[model samples]
Target: MTLEVMARCSAAAMAALAVMMAVGTDTVGQDTETVKPDERSKVSQYGIRWTFSEPRRVGRFVNGDWWVVGPATVVSVTPKPGPAPEDEVTEIKRNQFGDAAHQDDRRMRNGSMIVIKSSGRQGYDSRVKSYDPGLSVQFPRPLKPGQSLISSVSHTSLPNNNFSHKIMW
Candidate 1:
């Protein structure tokens, strides 16, 4: 490559590195703030509609990072009705991490944040798989066994949001 092209590439990489370092240093030692008792105890509702993936059952399972001290229960899961069952499929996975697997257990339980992840992986080309316009969600209270329901999740990417947005300096 020419010197000019190499110089430009080097500059861009350095800029990205600096951003990561600054952001990493700021949050390295901090902990997720404690959430109020009311927030954890109360129930909220949001309806979601999106294509989802099913993970293969491995072996034994354990309570993961997203498990809080609440009475949360999954009612049911059904495929989208009609011929086109998978109009919005993203991807599928072999391992089921469970919700909140990426966050700390304590923080996920009693914190203000909710961490949601896609079951499947996205393709190399980001634009081709844009999951349509969107759908409104109503995340409701925990359900009972007798009650029947379907689960759906939605996610969107912010421009240039693949990396940390928080900076230290």
Candidate 2:
């Protein structure tokens, strides 16, 4: 088509779009509205804000599993270093953590203990039933071009495993 015809068609399309938009929103918006954030995700399992430091690509695993596996640090917004036990170490409390590591355990701002548990295969929570510890060379899930291994989504096991063992005096 000629340039003049193309320009007329474009102008006509724009005019039609404007008309549709005007017709769609007869009931407009309010001037002011109160907004609030989601309360569910406000705090992490540690009873405080926590996140993984920006992980850099160091290289993949030998078996071709992960693209990177370098030293990742846990940055605690409010790192509460638990007081060293002056008294003799009693029966190391396993109730406050997922794994039975006393030395790696620390308390939170809300007096809740945070235990560091190493993830087993591919971030699969070891405590759960049927988990792949990252490297899945054996039972590889058959995925399409746009598909992925859903079971491969490994989330770090939260301290106390979402249950509280707080003893009330």
Candidate 3:
């Protein structure tokens, strides 16, 4: 088509669209009621936020499960952490089978912990069921709204099946 004809057709189509949108808005807005900010429901508020730092690409497991760790802060509005709802917690207990030196049974809530959230396997040939894409350090202690603790993930399991009680910086 010619430039003039195309421009006219485009202009006519835009005009019609504007008219339809104006009519639709008028009809839809008539039945709507203005909602105040204070009147909104607060049930969805958890009062906790996680601020993650730049992730470092840590070494990958032999099974092709790549891992990354970074410092994180857990900001909470209230002293007591949000109520523990069963639906939010995924309990995965790793039982010690053999006579391993590391016998410490750790829980996430007991103290500061590192939570690894993954997006699943990145490669099809990976032996691991999921991939450890990223991890964040969390504090069990309460934190004020503007307060944050300096924490990061560390590997305790040492070389040759040894374990370190203290995590070196």
Among these predicted structures, which one has the highest TM-score? 3
Alpha-carbon runs more than 4 Å astray in model 3: 1-28, 39-74, 77-107, 110-118, 121-134, 137-169
Selected candidate, larger TM-score, 1 vs 2: 2
Cα lDDT tens digits, model 1, 35-73, are 322223212223322111221111111321122222243
Model 2 per-residue lDDT tens digits across residues 1-169: 1222212111111000000011233233576543321212112322233222543222222443222121322333222222223442323334334544222222111111111232321212222222223322122122122212211111122233211234421
TM-score for candidate 1: 0.17
Ranking by TM-score: 3, 2, 1
Instruction: Evaluate residue 89 in candidate 3 and report its C-alpha lDDT on the 0 to 100 scale.
Output: 28
Query: Whole-model Cα lDDT per candidate?
Result: 0.20, 0.23, 0.22
For every candidate structure, what is the RMSD over all alpha carbons to the true structure, in angstroms?
19.7, 23.8, 23.5
Select the stronger candidate by TM-score from 2 and 3: 3
Residue 17, model 1: Cα distance from true site in angstroms: 33
TM-score, cand. 3: 0.20
lDDT of 3 by residue, 36-98 (tens): 211111111122222223222232334432222222223321222222233432223232553
Segments of candidate 1 deviating more than 4 angstroms: 1-64, 68-129, 132-136, 141-157, 161-169
Clash tally for model 2: 6
